[model samples]
Target: MHDLEGVDRGVNPQKTSVSALALQLEELLVSSDRRGMAQVRQLWTPGYLHTAAELFVRHCQRVVIVSGFPVGETYETDGPAGAIALLQGVKDCGGQARLVGFTPYIDRLRNCVAGLPQLNQRDLLALDRSGDVCEQLQGYMAGFAPTLLIFVAVPGQAADGCYYNPRFEDISDRTLPWEKLLELADCYSIAIADSGNHLGMGRVADPLARLSIVPAVSWTDGLVIADIANWGACGLLALASAFVRKNLLRNLHLTPLLEVLSRSGIVDSVTGMATASEDGLPAFSGEAVVTTLRNAAQTLQSGF
Candidate 1:
């Protein structure tokens, strides 16, 4: 309600402090200057995160969260934890939310759910990791009737029509065709990614070529890029909770859920070993990011 619209990167910071905080939040989330990701900075709309929260809170009633990127026998540790937080945020907004992924992610979500029952194991949906899932996906769409689709660290096919990990290794045989699934729903889509390897980077693929990885062929209605996928998801949660007047971060069990994820045979994208770290950053790193986001959200909501 701070009249954030039409404000040019917080032109009137004195009165539009909420917009200022939200704009600052946006800048913080996409500050990863490494890997030449800054090339797409031009495409990212100013105050778009707050705008997205408004759209989601006002329009979305049913949602499906797509995540999980497996490496070898290990799943990517980034997606599950963030997916859980997003699921909670969605439910807080009075939307029915479900998280869909491969067996590894579903397993971790289930394990984490034993301690965090708020996630509800029944909301976890699994798709075959290396098989054709067209029928399965269609059944899920028909059953859930989600109004929005969210991709968290899920990889997208490259221009060569193959899916690759950050290492540029083809993981097509191990990953799901997630882009096709979101297209099938024909609903609102948001992508949270760190690099061009993830789904929906196609929105800024050309500019991302400087990052080295071939940009994804899939595009989404909205995209949020953090140096790490989990951090971006937390940033999104902060904006959403502020708009809805709910403290969605209070119940965020990021640490415990991440502990469960570490034990779930998922390797870090950087270390290539199973640990609580994400891409080699320590586990507590996510905690710091989440805390920062929570504080920002409080500042905006308190109108300080």
Candidate 2:
């Protein structure tokens, strides 16, 4: 999947090519220049979406997707749908997938994706961020021995050892430090997020440092940034589906999914309200992304 050489099989001669489709995905997802991340976005240039998707399918076996960014009493809506989508996507690619996050949030995320079929409850793990681990999490994950670790919008530790919200407040207590797990990374792992504040986004910390957003101390082998974390997840799946010639997100009902999450009290990361908006954008924005992605990926009609 990394090579993109074989992805262009069909010839519409008019529709956007897979490479151009990747650029389109990037334009929508990583379009933010407000944080001075324009330079940061260029780090994985040319084909960040395609590169991340290719990296995912290549190392998707035994994948553990870590997500859930904590808000006041609940979690943000940006992460859940994306994380679940990634988990489902990984499984669709014939990989054994699992998801882990802090308690309460994990429970809520599990509830949101409950209607999705073939997902086992055991695959959803809740780590206690209260005290130190009640059990040996590292050892437990060692048992799983994930081939790829995909973190979608999980908060990252700053240089001061605290996780900060966009307002520059300390939220470290609510986060689970995944450093121990990230230590297992090789050349094959993927992280989907918007800003440098997310886990595994340290790769672009240098470019984003001038901005007010605190950069993460952790980095990943592959980073996929988006306008919002959910869009990042969608683009990742869309690109992967394009490459593999199978619609991984075709079953994902975006509207109902957000409605379910919103009803369950998952708030927007920016507004901190249990509304349909994701990171302050209208509900339809996500729908538009998925719709465009569906049309974009449809042209590449050959299997991996």
Candidate 3:
């Protein structure tokens, strides 16, 4: 969902007609330049929401979703929200979703799942460094035969062959090289992220590097960029709900999700502190995003 300013300039009208709910959801999720770092980049395209939604419905069945970015010394408050939301979205669409994360953060991931049973996602995975992580994932894929592989807020490898956090600092040892799993031919890949450091941002590495937000290149078949990674996933759910007209995301409650995660040691990625927030947004910001997303779904459901 690269937010390109002029993607609709000469494209097919039907393919480029982004719905109002999708547009409003995009606006609410774009980074507000909070750090004054001016690093919040909008790498989206017209009809991204529709395109991703169509992909979700037409081709995805058993899906593998990966998240869990360690901000400083622990898992942060960004990835899980998006991952959980997407898991619920997938299940609501008659698909099965399996959650994967580093072993260090598996407990936190479990906490998120246990606290939100309404999402009905129970398949959680732990990527231990004891063996080849990619091989294990390939084995899992062989068994599950997923149709889509989605990475949300997962770090991407840089030119230095190491994973870097948002500050351009190295974090390779703590992250799994899960991007390598994309080599599997059985499924298409979609990445949801807010910055260039994410696994999917490799598709636009040059633009991100020019802005100095990304230092290395990585790629994914489909990319969804947003202000907060979770918000992008929520937008996808909204689009899916509209497409199926079944409220696929009705059970997603962002505030309670954040609070559960906060108590479970999920810190704010931006502040690097344990707070019930995403990136560095306050509680109300999370509330506003969830409200806007629900409103968008309501609008679409009402056939407006």
The root-mean-square deviation over C-alpha atoms between each candidate and the true structure, in angstroms, is 5.1, 5.2, 5.1
What's the C-alpha lDDT at position 116 in model 2?
54
- In terms of lDDT, the poorest run of 10 residues in model 3 is 7-16
What TM-score goes with each of the models? 0.88, 0.87, 0.86
lDDT (C-alpha, whole model) for all candidates: 0.74, 0.74, 0.71
For model 2, residues 1-304, the per-residue Cα lDDT tens digits are 0112222232221366667777766765655543444557775456777788888878888888888888888888888888878888887888888888888887886675565564568878888855556345665666887888888899988888889878787888787777667664443677887777888878776667666787887877788887678878988887888666778877776767777788878988778888887777767767766666555555443432
User: Largest TM-score belongs to which candidate?
Assistant: 1
- Clashes per candidate, residues 3 or more apart or on different chains: 0, 1, 9
Error of 2 at 277 (Å): 2.2
Model 3 per-residue lDDT tens digits across residues 157-257: 88778998867778988888886778854778888877778897767664575565644477777776777788788877776666776666677778888
Window of ten residues with lowest summed lDDT in model 2: 1-10
Q: What global local distance difference test value does model 2 have? A: 0.74
- Which digits, one per residue and each the tens of the lDDT, describe model 1 over residues 269-300? 77778788776777776676676777666555
> What residue runs in model 3 are displaced by over 4 Å at the alpha carbon?
1-21, 31-45, 119-121, 302-304
Give the Å error, residue 94, model 2. 1.3
